[model samples]
Target chain A: MWDTFILNPMINALLMLYDFLGNNFVLAIAVFTILIRLLTLPLNLRQQRSSMKMQEMQPQIQAIQKKYKDNPQKMQEEFQKIGYNPAESLAGCLPLLIQMPILIGLYRAIIIVLGSTPQSLFELTARVYDYINLTDLLPISNKFLWLNLAQPDPLFVLPVLVFGTMFLQQKLMTPATKKQESKGKKQQDDNPMAGMTQSMQWTMPIMFGFFSLQFQAGLSIYFVLSNIIGIGQGYYMRRSMAQLKEEQATKKPAVIKAESETAVASPPQQSKQDDAALDAAMKGTPEERKQYQPRKRTSKRKRRRR
Target chain B: MYAAKRPLRRPVIFLLIIASYLFVACGVQTANTNWPGLSTDGEKVYVAYGPEVVAYDVESQSKTWSFPAETNPTLQFFAAPSVQDGRIILGDFGASGGMLSPGVVVTLYALNDTDQGVPGSIWTNGELVSDRVVAPPLQVGDQLFVGTANNFIMSIDATTGAKQWEFEVGHSIWGQPAYKEGVLYLSSLDKSIYALEAETGQELWQTELSGALASSPVVNTDLVYVASFDNQLHALDIQTGQEKWAASAQDWIWDAPAFADGVVYFVDIQGNVYAVDGASGDQIWSQQLNLPVQTSPVVVGETVYIASGDDLDAENPQGALTALNVADGKQQWQKTAPGPLFTTPVVVGDSIIVALQSDQDLLIAFDLETGGQNWDYLPPQE
Candidate 1:
């Protein structure tokens, strides 16, 4: 499945793109990497939403904890009522999982195309095959610029660039600041992502940088492009976060109306903390977007129960 | 020089690996650049010792004066001195060691009566011994012809060493060329022997031999004899390379086969001698000696001489010089010493001088008839 979905198609596409664009392999790899990032953009967006949803629920979670500080069962029941689950916040991991096969394919393509290294002898099913010549018109061997495709690049420039781009992407994509729990009124303003720490931030870049020195330069170029695209997507998503915030604010007035209806039926006034939360949710245009609509218990409660 | 992308330093290591494998698989040979010249003149023995043409006087049992007449500042003596037309012609057949390239130069020298009786340089040319020449000169009329390491058989002016013409053969011609009335015979490392016109070097035809011919092509009156590493003794037609008849030996036929009155005397690597009727190419007698024979044979009137060994016993090492009766292939007498001589005996008039090399070295002489010890001369330092 990978040969068709990733390897063969990517190889053929890269070859075709190289043929059309003066057969410049380095440039082709950069363009190809961007194309792949664009194709997987939807999955990346869903992962962002999942992270945003988790950040918004941090305050509600704190409130649930305060309401039943001594009763663990009551806290759990309140969490079940609200859309707050620790597991759903891990949505960013899906993009990485989906890209694993694509990443390996890119590695192999760079090894064979840029380094001119053939696949392992065992993987070769036939005695002869068509050569994918990148330097077909060059007078000298496929060595060019400062790199020798036959050997590891000596300049160390490519590896550094690859790691730098990865670090930049990671830093820019970090949206929320991790926060500590408090014994007061709950607020989603507490940074949800500040919890992600430093161990992985430096470790991943160092490990990949070390490997980039040994791998082909072409793959290094692709890696750099992938990171750059990821950073750009992060910026775009962050820029559009204001719209998401507005949508959340617009749904707040209906929440307050329902609370008032509850007061008329069983009680008159509720806790001042709940009033403050509903007011915060209705502070902006959230009140205008909120409308009284029929809620589907089958999809909401049943799905949450499962 | 190597490509920037490719690691060229490893190739030298790879060659070492290859050489080591060959050392274990096949064997190594002692390399000697001094050529011991071969001839059919029956009166004189010519050799190139260092820079001079030295000839041994058959009657006086002493070497004639060394001739410095033929000197090439750039060439070396790769093969022994070939005596032709009362002159000593030496080929610079990679003997100098600097020109690892092929195609040696052939230089001739004549006795200068005015120049203090020293042999004076007459003429020198590259046509005679063109690179990698181990073969002696084959004289046809006024022109002397020989093959080269580059796989070309050429004719040169016997008096001037000027090239007349050339004919490309299969591979490097390591064998000494042979000649008949007008046809020139040559063999190559590519396992093919060719017959060419003496004057123009035009190819008449080429015959495929079993293996490479590294030995000197020995010739009789009617039959041209040659040996191959394929362990085959071929008697080819004098005018064409067509096989007159062929004989087989136990191992690679490396040395030039000696021809006597009516029989062809040759040895195999397995220390066996087979006397074949020269006219019919029939094996009249076969005898196994002590060890393998890689050297050529020396034959006189009714007796044949061969060098054989048994085992490398350090002190004895199975080395001996044996003389056999040609008629019955029976050993007449055996001379034992620290010897496994690689050179053929030079029979000068009544005494035979053989250079025997073993742990020690000496040039020994003996009477031709009774094999009595005459005198021995060992080089002072070496």
Candidate 2:
């Protein structure tokens, strides 16, 4: 069932793409990765939005943690009151979950399409549909740039590019914590979770770079291209969000300006109820906070755009 | 409380990503490693499987000896071992730094029939000829001709294993070279066949075909019969390398054609057997066994024997030795095995020997007259 539904289709599609792209396997892989990214753009956008919302709630979440340091059950109730569920926040990873299988399928497809060995070539002939003519594509020229698509890049250029692009993408996705910058070195050192997140930002790319060194160059090409495309998409989305924020600021300039002045005049005199509500909204699920607070009409506009 | 779990998510996701990386990394290493090829000297059968070449004695129904004695993880043999002058000459697809590494070395080893040591009785070993060797070596006189993944047909001294000459082709040569009367006929993945001088490695004539040739050509007195991936067989004139006639098959012909008494018999990968006239290239009769056949048909007297099996379907995959009358293409007898048969059947005296590409058996012998099981041999389990 897996072969019929995923692997065979991917292999045939890859072969078809190779045929359509003038038998250039490297071009085929690049085009295929771009097509896949475009097809899953909506899912990626949703995940990005969910992540941004989580980042936006970080300050209030930290405030809630500080306020309820001694009351664990109360904190749990507060989190529920704010409508937060840990599981629901993880919905942002859905795009990645969907991409994993496709990536694996593409890897297998590239290997099968290249058909490096006699046995594998025969197996490819069997997997290929009869209508898809690959006679001229037999013994595919794996040479693309300085790499052989069937083998890893000999010059280490692809691995380095893959690492660089992936790191950039990860850097764009991981929201830098302002509290960490404000905290003393000693406090930052004491927080193991913060340390782990920082380490992961570097480790993920290095690990993938290691994989790119071992996998076929064709697959590595896909990885590097997909990472670069993701970075571009991320940048575009971030810019759009920034533009939306600017438009909102312009529309409600007087109200925000007055709040800023009042906030500056007496930082500690803000109402405890307002603080509690903000904390609750931060702890709550994105949907729950949107329902409970209902302060921003732009959220509805954003939904319409999505 | 949710903040407490937030930190755990990163580690979990990290582990999941690492797990997936390891899964794909490990999965890619398990390529299609089985390309079993065999040769027989009428008494002993030599089969190449992975890194070891084992010689099975037909009479004793046991392994006489295996090259290297111990498996070398870097060494992998796919081409059938050519037995001549009491030596086993074969090429290995060697990779350094684990199985996934791209560096491949086609090392040719000539081992004595009976010798065991740490390095184990290798008479002469040649340096790397190419990235890989998938075609069986052809031994004529004192010269050994083997085609390589580097698109070169190399001639090595059979006794000393020294490279004598090399002929570069348009693409990789996956088919064994056929030699006749000072001329060598080679079919390549470049969709062309060339006639080269056996002594000097000079091309005499070349003829382009419709598709890449994956099977070796069989040379008659004046004609060379070769099969290609285009699902057609071409009979070329040996002297001029010109296509004399062409015949179509059901699928890609991955096995060499067998010729005897003006009739040429060949089988495609789809288990469709065709017996064509050697003079006119007309299909005389064809039979379908519904199993994929990678081995060429072996003709012994009036019976044409073929090994057929399907490895793709696990549930009902069948392997059998089907014998048909050469005159009428009628099924004389059929004997079934536990798995696929990828090597050609060799007739040794009264028994027809076949190598199985399955876990249950390594080689099996059947009675030529009755198609009854004589004995089966399995490699020593490690």
DockQ per candidate: 0.01, 0.21
Among incorrect, acceptable, medium and high, the docking class of model 2 is incorrect
Query: Which residue runs of candidate 1 sit more than 4 Å off their true CA positions?
Result: A1-306, B1-35, B38-44, B49-53, B67-78, B95-117, B126-130, B219-223, B308-319, B337-339, B357-362, B380-382
Cα lDDT tens digits, model 1, B114-206, are: 212566666754334433455555665567776665457777776766778888775555566876666777776667777777767777878
User: Model 1: chain B TM-score vs. truth?
Assistant: 0.76
Model 1 docking category: incorrect
Could you give candidate 2's per-residue lDDT for residues B35-97 as a string of tens digits?
A: 577888878888888768888878776677877666776567778888877767878765443
Candidate 2 chain B, run of 10 with poorest lDDT: B96-105
> lDDT per model, in order?
0.58, 0.75
Candidate 2 Cα misplacement greater than 4 A, ranges: A62-77, A80-83, A179-197, A248-306, B1-30, B72-75, B98-102, B115-127, B158-162
Q: Cα deviation in Å at residue A270, candidate 2?
A: 20
Which 10-residue window of candidate 1 chain B scores lowest in summed lDDT? Answer: B95-104
Tens digits of per-residue lDDT, candidate 2, A184-262, equal: 4432222333445456677878777767756788998999999999899878877888787678679877544433332
lDDT of 1 at B121: 68
